[model samples]
Target chain A: MQVFELIIGKLLPYATLVILIVGLLYRLNRWQRAAVGNIALYPSAATRWRLFGKVLSEVTLFSSFRQENQALWKRTWPFHVSLFLILLGHTRLITDWPLRVGLGLSEGTVNAISAWGGGICGVVALMTCLLLLARRFGIQRVREISTGEDYGVLILLLFILLTGNAMRFFTHYDIAEIQQYFRTLFSTAPTQVPHDPLVLLHFLMVQLLLIYFPFGKFLHVPGVFYSKTLLAKDY
Target chain B: MEGHVQVNETELQTVIDQVKAIKNGPRVLQLYMDICAHCGVCAEQCHVARTMPESRTNPAARSDHIRQLYKRYGSTWGQVLKAIGAARDITEDEVAVWQRDFYECSGCRRCAKFCPFGIDNSILTRKGRAVVHALGKSPFMMSETQRISDETGNDEGQTYAAFVEACRFLCEEVKDDWDIDVEIPIDRKGADILFIPASADLVSFPETHMGVAVFFKALEIHDGTTWTMASTAFDGANFGLFTGDDPHMARKNQAAYDACIDLGVKKLVIGECGHAYRIAKRMGPTASHFGNPFETTNIFLLADEYLQKGVLKFDKRKVDEIITYHDPCNFARSTNVFEEPRRLLSAMTDNFVEMTPNRTENWCCGGGGGLAVMDGAEKVEMIDGTFLDYRMKVGKMKVDQIMATGANYCAAPCANCKRQLMQLMEHYETGVKIGGVFDILGNAIVLEETKVKAGAKVAS
Candidate 1:
């Protein structure tokens, strides 16, 4: 148990972080090295700024997806938006941003907001993940095109969300201990990790997701920028 | 099976190697192959998938063939992921399926519009076709037309003398039919504009050719904007684009550029062909050759400019039937030519109506990517269906869209669209008159000297 904790709770975090960054850089470099000609769709953005704005809107809003399929958009837009907001909320794990703590709220007030807001986001993400999984299985056309990797990724996300929600609603975590652990890990110091099994499992799963990202469909997150820019930029 | 090519292990290995090398090729294609989420948004938007409803016809499934081969052979991670069924080795049967499924796609790019990653399946489709073409397994008609173009400088195999004679004969026919003396200037040096159209327009749809000649004559009388057709590079339709032969496309476009330079024209005008214009304007060397010495513009843009300037007048009542425009995939989506054709149509007829989904989102006429020029398998050992029957089957959606508009006339400006649509109308017995947007221009344009004749026709 001690060895498992040392590996998952200590060593793997740094190892996976390096792997994540290097893998992403390798993939991005591959994409950049390939030759891309002027294969723009017609009536593309007229200027560089407009093209930037267009790609930005597409990344944030999934505007093209909304225009084509409203039904799928209703589920996916919220899935992405909530996931983004949840990621922002998770900044509390490392250090509180001035925007949150600068409000001068009492610790009790801050804790209440974090509990409620974090819980709601967890629930939304969990529900959307299940719904997306159902969609992959339920829709015949989607099912036809889907491979094992598609289902495997969704199942992994489901477990991560499940562990996260369990930690949020059922299990207890020490915020100060978790913060100290992350601070020491970031600073390259000897670390003491929070010993809660659920917290460790969730962290390990997130690390796995990050490690697997560049090798799988999760590349869609960054690949969208290149794909959209190539298709939508005028020049 | 009837038209499938026989290949051995060596040929199959060659195709797999070519696909593997594609990873080192175009970034758009590489990125798309890497990033597709298999979300099936494209299947919902694809006309062929909607009509056919087969796994092979689905855009994602079709692109997956190449993606699978790519994953198996291209990357280290992909090879590791092979245990999870993410990738696999290529098979002889899979190559046969690749030949069919890749050719089955029209390369319209509608699927690209709605994809979450904006993955253009058409690019993958073209890549797949390119590899198959490397194997000498392209459809018979597609390969044959390219051969003819290579030999005769036109897909129709019309020689230089025959081209000049055809132009002269068409002028005489216009004089006899419409009582207009419009000359089709050929190989004329120092002209300000060089007009190149699909060679099919000169013979199959002669009226579209006549309309351009009259419109150019009007331009000449209006402001001395002289335009001439080049005997050396008269045909603008390129089968290389359809068959995914880059060398062939570049060679064909070089002829057009040489013609422009030899004539010393200020502008190169492409008439009524969408893919040709797309290749000339952006895709091929004409877009960047010698710093783009001559400007490339479409005929409708020039015509609409003149009409807006009041240099050309139209007798709107001359075109009596209700009209709807078919936006060729290459024009509407590939070249941004959606509005000019509609504007010209509005000027020519008060009864113009739009199909349900017009412009960039419009469905293909079921004959994009050079499928219209190919009727079926014309030679043995070719890997394709009886494509005329295939076109008719997939073209049912377009026939329905036109019928829903209840328009008697459809102005499809591209040569491929016209051929496929005309056959669709006849095959479905829809009684719709399929012609070019300029075909209406010929019927309705009131030339300065021909106003009396135009008024008489309107009166009658």
Candidate 2:
């Protein structure tokens, strides 16, 4: 309990910090939506379905990766795959109720999967970040077009993953304490939160990422799905 | 030696110098120079580029050849250094290849329509041809056609006797077929419309010419006249539009306009050549020699207006055969004459199946731009390479749609489209016949109130 209280001392401020950052992201999305309303020329149900299918194929399945320049595709596919897997691994942090209800697994089993997924994601993320950064600076056309924002996104993502995996794999943190902190925030209960420094660092980095995502082409993660799929030539 | 004129070097050089002086005369050239992005999207969209072997898929390869001249003359030192670094140079052999390539294109705006930036590649091709023309390097066929246009007022060099004889023959044929004494008036003053078609229609595409004559006869309207101009401008087929010489372009248009004005016709109805119509309707007004406020309504627009007002009627029972319409790239994309043709087709036929990429998105028949008239074996490489491939791919898709419907006829208004579609049909052996929109209309024209002449039969 004392250890939990100490962890909460460091992490509570970041909860407020995450709230503020998420608020900014919401505002940015709202602003963009207002700015570019109804820009699609041919909006229809069939078009929507086509666009949805295309986005799923492109972003999740990396359908376009197959047709893209081969060397670039190889580096990009692994990075994207790792990032998605890492995101899925983090679902346990948000809601343990799903694991409790669906799997009926003990906390130990859930923790093992999370840790394994997190570690694999971290290794792939670091390697991808390194290779992509090298290629962006090395390739003539890519180098010419890449901005400071591009490098910043790559570096920040690397930091988040590195810190996340280090805390999960290297340090022994109480999963119940982390889950209880999340449950308190969700339920509006003023419970004491985790105070682990590595957890606090991870939360801070994630909040910063949320604040940054809307402002940069990182928004293109969603934007490309809409543009490429929705606007693709029908015939 | 028979119909060809000998090229005088000194005179040709003088003409070239004169053209070079006026090359930068128009704001159009400035607009062209500033607007193009060189994204090669035009080349990518171009059927010629797609169908051409990897060795020659770049349509802009010729334009790039001419771009060297622009870089040499128009660019700053930094630009020159960049061009030099890129190994760009204008040489005689390069010039010769450009001449062949420039002529090989049908000047269809299929590429222009698909370009994200709207870079008017056909216009640039024309401009390049103009530069080549200035250098006395015009292709022999085009130059000969231009010469015939200059001397005989038409490309075919048809005399007034032949012109009248053809008209009379058509009138007699109409009288024999339709049982009507429809007079095709010549040299009548204050006619509502002065109908000027390419001489090709009178001789080669008789069915289309007869369609026009039938259209006029069925309306029982006599306010139109056809004339063979006293000078070389009788044919509206502007070879200069293809070759890119503005003065020669101006000369051809000026002659046509002068004849129209001389006849005191209120409106000039140009026949179904896409570039010819574009030149007459758009470029003619801009050429300084035409003296601005140049007035002409495309014949297609006239047809549309008439059809809308119930001035024209057709018996759809006559056209029971399944048909599809190919929008000539010029009329479809360039001039926005898409809906009217379809409207006409719908009225004329019961089974009008639209090709997949119909209207603005329709593919070129691989023979527009100026490739239709260009005489060279290398043209096969351009057509079979780019135009044919584009048409075939798009055409195969269209052909499949067409085959699914089991349509026997494909109706295209533009002569170039008809010509190209004919070749495609032959190449693919698609077992489909191609003709003009009015050919269908003429076949379907039912004389209800108007009495047919006792002995008249439809002219073939």
Task: Write down the lDDT of every candidate, Cα atoms only.
Answer: 0.86, 0.60
lDDT tens digits by residue: candidate 1, B1-460: 8659454788778877888887788788878778988888998888889888878788999998888878888887767777766787777576667778887899999988888898999998898888878878787888988999999999999988899899999888777877777788888999999999999999899889988988887787777688899999999999889989999999999999999999999999999999999999887777743477889888988998998898878998688999999999998888889888888899888999999888888999899998887776644233446888778888998999999998999999999999999999999998999999877887788888645454335324
Chain A vs. native, model 2, TM-score: 0.75
Candidate 2 local lDDT, B1-460, one digit each (tens): 7537444566434433433333344333333332332324455455566555342435544444444344344444324333333224344244455565676555665654443332345665777677667766775667778888888778788988888888788767665765545555676666656677777777767677777767766554423233222233446777776777667788887777777777676667777666677667666642323544335766678778878877677878777778887777767665557777788888887788877766766767666655555434433222344434444443344455455656789887776667667767776898998887766766777654534442133223
Leading candidate by TM-score: 1
True contacts kept of 2: 0.00
| Best candidate according to lDDT | 1
What DockQ does predicted model 2 obtain?
0.02
Candidate 2 residues lying further than 4 Å off, grouped into runs, are A1-235, B1-40, B78-80, B83-87, B221-234, B285-295, B378-405, B448-460
CAPRI-style quality class for the chain A–B interface of candidate 1: high
All candidates' TM-scores? 0.96, 0.59
Worst 10 residues of 1 chain A by lDDT: A92-101
